[model samples]
Target: MELTVSPAPHIHDNLTVSKCMYNVIIALLPAFAVSLYFFGIGALIVTLSSILSCVIVEYLIQKYLLKEKPSIGNGSAILTGLLLAFNLPSNLPIWIVVIGSIVAIGIAKMSFGGLGNNLFNPALAGRVFLLISFPTQMTQWPRPIVSRWNYTDTETGATLLSKLKEEGSQWIEQIDIANLWIGNQGGSLGEVGAIALLIGFAYLLYRKIISWHIPVSILLTVFLFSFVLACGQETGNMQNIPMWQYAFDFALIQLLSGGLLLGAIYMATDYVTSPMTSKGMIIYGIGIGILTVVIRQWGGYPEGVSFAILIMNAFTPLINNYIKPKRFGNHRS
Candidate 1:
């Protein structure tokens, strides 16, 4: 037999795209279930429509548009659909869900040469696109406990974080930490439930689907920075409350009340979009965390997670370029 020489990374593992993507889908189920339990028919309709739209779009693009083999079998389209739906209002019109799915798979994913080649997270790009174009429908969040069966005609309400933005720290009186944790607040399809998102985060960590670097970095940065901001202020609500307690509550609200957990755990850590090295991931995460707090506190929007992630996604290439592993026999440091 002839001898052959190949480049390094000579070892092969049993991992497949199918297994990895399916595991992610599995990990997302806890949050998805919470959305169903709270939003019911609305959630189901949006999810199915988004998934179907994404799958069909990818198939057609590969078959006819690109004249290449279909890649939807890898479940990237399905995953994109689920994530897009997660980032959207559950009561959004079915046609809008279709539009978002098309944008996710067509423009964000396929247009960039498919899965591993995309520069931005497809779901979030789709979300930002929808948010900018249809701000009214996208921002209308249906409150929980209204009805499981109600999809469209349900009463719309502002989220706690929005109230915080409008009414200042005083709105904290209206928000119960327990209700927010249990997913009874008004928000997007999957982002309202802190407990469910945490459960999903735990599963992803346990499965080794993602490392702790990105998520931990983003969360810790948000907490520490927000604690500093809280300590500098003297809101009346915190007068009687201990300083530490008030700061903790303020940071916790920043953490739990929006898509921070969702973005930190799932969206920001996307394999193709995030940094390749631990150091680079940390930098990426820190940027996301700081930008999120800045936007939440000063920017016009009440929530800044999706925008923050997309913005950081733009820097991922620069991060990877500057922070790379040492060469095999050319270590300079």
Candidate 2:
């Protein structure tokens, strides 16, 4: 009889690298369906192009550049591509989508030794690169429903966040919260679908793919911070609405609008870039929430989730160092 000894993780379940990645993909499907319904052909084109480009780029980089076996079968590249596409305007040109994919796989991912080692979320890195390189195209969000059949030629409109940033509280009453929740507005493919994103979040939780620490902490921080700000401001057009009501509505908008939900639930929860410990995750999420609000309120850009996640990603190592879980089998004196 032969006995084999392994390190910690001796008791294992059916989970694998591929399984986790695919689970995330499955979770993202509801959001993708909402995007297709709202953005139509443009969403499909952008998504396909991004996914194909990411897989191809990673395959080629591994096979030729790194002289290693391609790992696209693990589904990391596909997830990266899907997330990148989610961060982008659906009407963005295919060439630009390809460029972002290449950056995502070739630089942010492959250059960092391919998944599980990257410093930043590959999708956010690629999206930020594109946002800087092609600000005009990236910001021109196609209007939902009306742009169904259109691609790059779709009619464009400002997102709710952008409107709020530009016009302040005056335009608050005009926003149709119901329509926004159901994704009948202008924004990135994933950003508009609040309900779909929440559904996906629930699925991820049900599958135990992610813990509640990161997502819940982020939402709480953003809500409380935004609520404080909302209550302090004098909008002057309250129109008989109670101040608390205005504050609550504004906080709700912060939760539903732009990429807050998607980023909080998906991107900030990336295993490689996020802290390992639950306490560390909460700290990381809090940092992301604060930075997101700061950038949206004062920074040049209207959206801040991508930037917030990436910035927190850079600090994950530090958070892990300081906030580690107790070592297994170790007892107190």
Candidate 3:
């Protein structure tokens, strides 16, 4: 009899990198459809441009610069591009979309040794880069449905967070929570569609593409923290509702508005950048949630999900070091 020696246990399932990437793409389709419904032709153009640019940039980098065979068929670049596009305004120029894709695929991903080795989420890195470099363009969110066909000339408006920041808590009363939930509000492609994002989240959970720890923890933290803040504030009950109900409504608004759902469900749960252990995932999620709220309430930026996720991504290595996972199998004491 011949004995073969190989690396430990060696149990493998059918799960592959491409399978996971494609699963995420499938999950994201609902949100993409919502964006198209709201943003129309602009959404289609930005999404396609971002995806093509990312794939082409990654392929060129791998083949020409890195002197390796391109692995563009694995769907990582496509996912990155789709995520980048989601983070962007629908009315953003094609040139900027191409540049953001370059930053996402070239600098954030390949420069850090490609997909699994990147410290930060590539899509977010690209988004932040564009936000900083093109502040006016990045902040110009087109009105939903009405501006769907206008592209660069779309009439723009402030996001709910921006309205809150500019007009104070009273403006909160005027906001239709139903509209926010149903993708009828003005914001980025991803920010407006809370229900769509939630649907995608459910699909991801159902397919076992991700565990519940990260998304749930982030959302719960945001809800609780925002509730506490709402309770502390002394705003008149403009709607004649009870203070407790008002606080609850405020917290719900925080949870459903802007990119909170998108970031919590999709971006913060990136396997490469988030912590490995379940406990560590919770810790990581809490950090993201806290930072996001702080930045929204106090920081200069109106939205903070991108910054929060990237900041926590930098801490993932430290979290893994401190919150070490238990070794598998039984051990004699």
Candidates' C-alpha lDDT? 0.89, 0.92, 0.92
Question: Where does candidate 1 clash, by residue pair?
Answer: none
Instruction: Determine the backbone clash count of candidate 2.
Output: 0
Ten residues in sequence with the least summed lDDT for candidate 3: 324-333
lDDT of 2 by residue, 220-249 (tens): 999999999999887877668888899999
Model 3: pairs clashing at backbone N, Cα or C within 3 Å? none
> What is the lDDT, from 0 to 100, of the residue 193 in candidate 3?
80
Top candidate when judged by TM-score against the true structure = 2
In candidate 1, how many Å is residue 160 off?
1.2
| RMSD, candidate 1, Å | 1.6
The per-candidate count of clashes, in order, stands at 0, 0, 0
Ranking by lDDT: 2, 3, 1
Q: For residues 280-321, write the lDDT of model 3, one tens digit per residue.
A: 999999999999999999999988999999999999999999
lDDT of 1 by residue, 1-333 (tens): 999899976887876888778888998898899989898899999999999999999999999989999988898889999999999888899999999988888999889998899999999999999999999999999877685688888888888788988887776656689977988888888787888888888888898889999999999999999999988866775577787877888898899888999899989989999999999999999999999999999999999999999999999999999999887799578
**Quality of model 1 by C-alpha lDDT:** 0.89
Best by lDDT: 2
TM-score of each candidate?
A: 0.96, 0.97, 0.96
RMSD of each: 1.6, 1.6, 1.7
